[model samples]
Target: MTRTLVDPYSVPDELRPYLQEVVQRTHALCGSDLVSVIAVGSVALGDYRHGRSDVDVTVVVDGTAPGPVVPELAAALAHPALPCPAAGLELVVYDRNFTARPSGEAGYLLDINTGPLLPERASVDPSESPAFWYVIDRSVALQAGRVLYGRPAREVIAEPARADVLTALRASVREHSSGEGHLADNRVLNGCRSVQFCRTGRWQAKRRAAEAVAASEERFRPLLRAALHSYERPSRTAATTLPTTDVHTFLAWVAERVDESSDADRRG
Candidate 1:
């Protein structure tokens, strides 16, 4: 059953039609089991630069849905004509029951990832990566997440503990800090945003966060500027101009700062 596709609300024009189809398809396939479809990450925040950001989403399903729903949604999303914009689609689907009681459960039924790094894949089991938790946490799923169907975003996801968010941020910094080339730029800019969020309980768009931190902090200006440039031209490593050694140094510094902040948060 193919659901009709219409322009989705609050979605960027580039991916709206495609995402609309994807969401509708999921609805048709899952029927009564479907709970909600949500847009998250850069797309939800309105900072999705064409050719640079991936379309990220979260779909919720009632617990009674059959186990095969994972693969079904993956197949529903893989439209040949509507190829994933930059970096492909990063999607996660959760069971309504699991989300309602997030403390003990692994929080998702399907984790579908497809992009430059790997072919389209869907895992029925939860991922060990901090990113999985990053999405499940309220920061991405509730604060920035936009509902495409069903319940309101806040009702679909639980408000995560502050400690959980801090833990995820620290782990993300540790993992991304080792990246080089274009990834180095991502690590730097994302580090600034994560740090800013940790310091002040507010979340801002990546480039805006970098600009705000650079303007007030002077020391991070050059690196943040280079990161913003690299973010725009992700394919051109040379355009970043910052040496690999410098990127590593900056990453290490950012990691240390995040650790210190996390420790302080825990203590306080």
Candidate 2:
């Protein structure tokens, strides 16, 4: 359950082989251009659930890989060819330059989203997309990313600024507040995680963060419990749909919590 370098034990038993395949494929395909492939998110945090979680990977390239390699990488790791074993594979490719500098702005070369739960689309061109997702992801990757291939993550992926991560977490709270996120489980769990990060400066697995928040924030216990159930048992039916009004309310509370922490940091 330890989130360490190439820790296969943390990855669900069903996903270990497929994740290995991803690492092998990237090494064979990208060759020298591929500097490191780091496993981030649930798998890295030891909270991955079969059929529920996506295999999140961050690939760091040598920064010298040409534009042609982008398309080539896109084709090689595309779903049908690679066939992700988890719900989906959330793969992002970045250059060494992108990871070397520690900043608030997020940058990437390619974002390949494929699998059963995800749409089969390869998004390139960082300019077209908002930096929110990348910024949040990079923060988590720096904290918990485990190497799947090539060098160790910390050797390449620089730690993002603390203030930038707080900003990204605030953006996540705003997203859930607007009711625009794709997953209900994520909305609930991420809200808890964001508050924990805002207050503690620690990034934790969603379930653990929810549990900790629920323990101390008794008012949120029922909602956090429902969120945990949905995340741990994705295929099973929940007793009740997460109430939208309640969700918005929780997010509003989260925004305030984050704001309080941000204000505290400024004062201290």
Candidate 3:
């Protein structure tokens, strides 16, 4: 199916009416079959940025379809007049069976039970796999989406706590950073660091310090530097492995330092 491009911000006036029409059309196509159409991703989270996002919508049918509906949905969204702004639309089709299984990709689970038609399920319990972070972090932002049937957007994503999501995010960042030669590893780490600061009002120059350390080395300097920064102060001991406790503690320290820096910034 051809993808539809959409402007992340300021949905075209034409687009709103088109979206309503599409939803109505989609509903009629399904016709009283128990199905749910939900919006998920950046637009759902109220965090969309223009020129850098797309629309993610999921269709959950009561029973498995003979074939994937993603292609069809894409085609519908890509209609010449409709023409989504970015790389068209991203559509996932699921049957009840598909929704029952835990999502293999971490943060991608839609949490259809409680969030909006398109809800952002952000909780990341440590017990959950690092894969969760990979999904959420790498998720393409959805500028806007609607539910064709069943449940409002807020009700679907409301159960998961922000803290749980944050924890999952942290684990994801650590996992990516630990993997060697991943250029985007630093981005994950920085994202986690930013979250930590926001949650606890603390900042660690760890990302910057780690970057410096990595740059100085000829090889995987960033990874090595991250490990060093994760260690407790004065001793400056480095380890071949990254223990979660040590990483968590280091994050805490970073947070404390950030708070201090913020205070200093205010005074200055």
* lDDT of every model, 2 decimals: 0.70, 0.79, 0.41
lDDT of 3 at 255: 47
Q: Which regions of candidate 1 fall more than 4 Å away from where they truly are? A: 1-9, 79-82, 102-106, 115-118, 131-138, 180-182, 234-241
Misplaced by over 4 Å in model 3 are: 1-15, 68-71, 78-82, 86-88, 97-148, 153-268
Report the lDDT tens digits of candidate 2 across residue range 1-268.
1222366665677887788777777776677777888888888888887777788899999865677777888888888788777878888898898789886665788888888768887778777666777887777877887777778878898888777787888887877777663567778888988988886787899999999989998887888898888777644233246878777778889899888877877898
> Which 10-residue span in candidate 2 carries the lowest summed lDDT?
1-10
Candidate that scores best on lDDT: 2
- Model 1 steric clash total: 0
How many pairs collide in each candidate, listed in order? 0, 0, 34
In model 2, the runs with Cα more than 4 Å from the true position are 1-7, 236-240
Using all chains and alpha carbons, the TM-scores for the candidates as numbered come to: 0.87, 0.92, 0.41
Worst 10 residues of 1 by lDDT: 129-138
